[model samples]
Target: MDNQHVDAWKDMIYPALISKKEELEMLGYEQATPEDVWKCLSVKVWKGEPEKRLHEMVQDIFHLKSSVYLSYLTIQSYENDDLAASVEALLGNTENKES
Candidate 1:
């Protein structure tokens, strides 16, 4: 994946991990280290394309309540930005065609 996609993935995962750390530990991951958790989650994200991974992350965050809605908001913001860019591109193409 590109750096931008990797960075966006990090932005989603890090906050969720930080907020869910205690819960994860309580759920039988107590012996696992931070890097271990990171590696596990990173692999899950890497298994899919960037957008699919992001959607899965957002759903996980919503269900996990990992960051108490923070992670969900972060992903939603990114989705909204993507939507806006798509809309702008479509509009620009239409204008160019008209011109």
Candidate 2:
């Protein structure tokens, strides 16, 4: 995949994985790698058809509960300015409202 799509994947998935760190540790995966967390979160997000679910998630990031700044930070951590810009463009003009 291209960098833009890879960035979108990281932008959507990494935060969810990070948020599960404590949970994964509590479940005896104290040494969990990013790949491990990715697997775990992917399973939790969709028990079946993960690739399809992930595609849907990429489309849904705009509707995520996370603040725009937080999302930007997550994308920036991966050094994907293009994805960060895409995220900002999607969120910049919107009112802060939870769904």
Candidate 3:
């Protein structure tokens, strides 16, 4: 995956990203943002890309399905909850030791 390619295409793809974000929101993902949409595609849709071209990226964004994005959000939410629980458990252990 080439970060350079993604960076180079960022400006050109902004509108498409925004459109995807809006689509997600209309489907009830109000927290959706352009970054989230891009990340989901980069991870799920692109899936270890050699680096997609601008047009391909824009097309992917435009065609992204709500179900796929919803699944991504659900998994992400669970992962974030797990991380928070782990942190709380670690903090609880530290407090117990201090006491």
lDDT of 2 at 64: 31
lDDT of 1: 0.55
Across residues 35-56, which tens digit of lDDT does each residue of candidate 2 receive? Answer: 5444433433435533444555
Clashing pairs in 3: none
Each prediction's whole-model lDDT (CA)? 0.55, 0.49, 0.83
lDDT of 3 by residue, 1-99 (tens): 334455567787999999888888888889999989888987778776546676777778888999889889899999999999999999999999999
Candidates sorted by lDDT, descending order? Answer: 3, 1, 2
RMSD of 2: 15.2
lDDT of 1 by residue, 2-61 (tens): 333443675556666565655666655464344444544444434443444555664454
lDDT score of residue 79 within candidate 1: 82
Candidates 1 and 2, the one with greater lDDT:
1
Against the true structure, candidate 1 reaches a TM-score of: 0.38
Candidate 3, residue 39: CA error in Å?
0.8
Q: Pick the candidate with the highest lDDT.
A: 3
State the weakest 10-residue window (summed lDDT) of model 1: 64-73
Q: TM-score per candidate, in order?
A: 0.38, 0.31, 0.88
Cand. 2 TM to true fold: 0.31
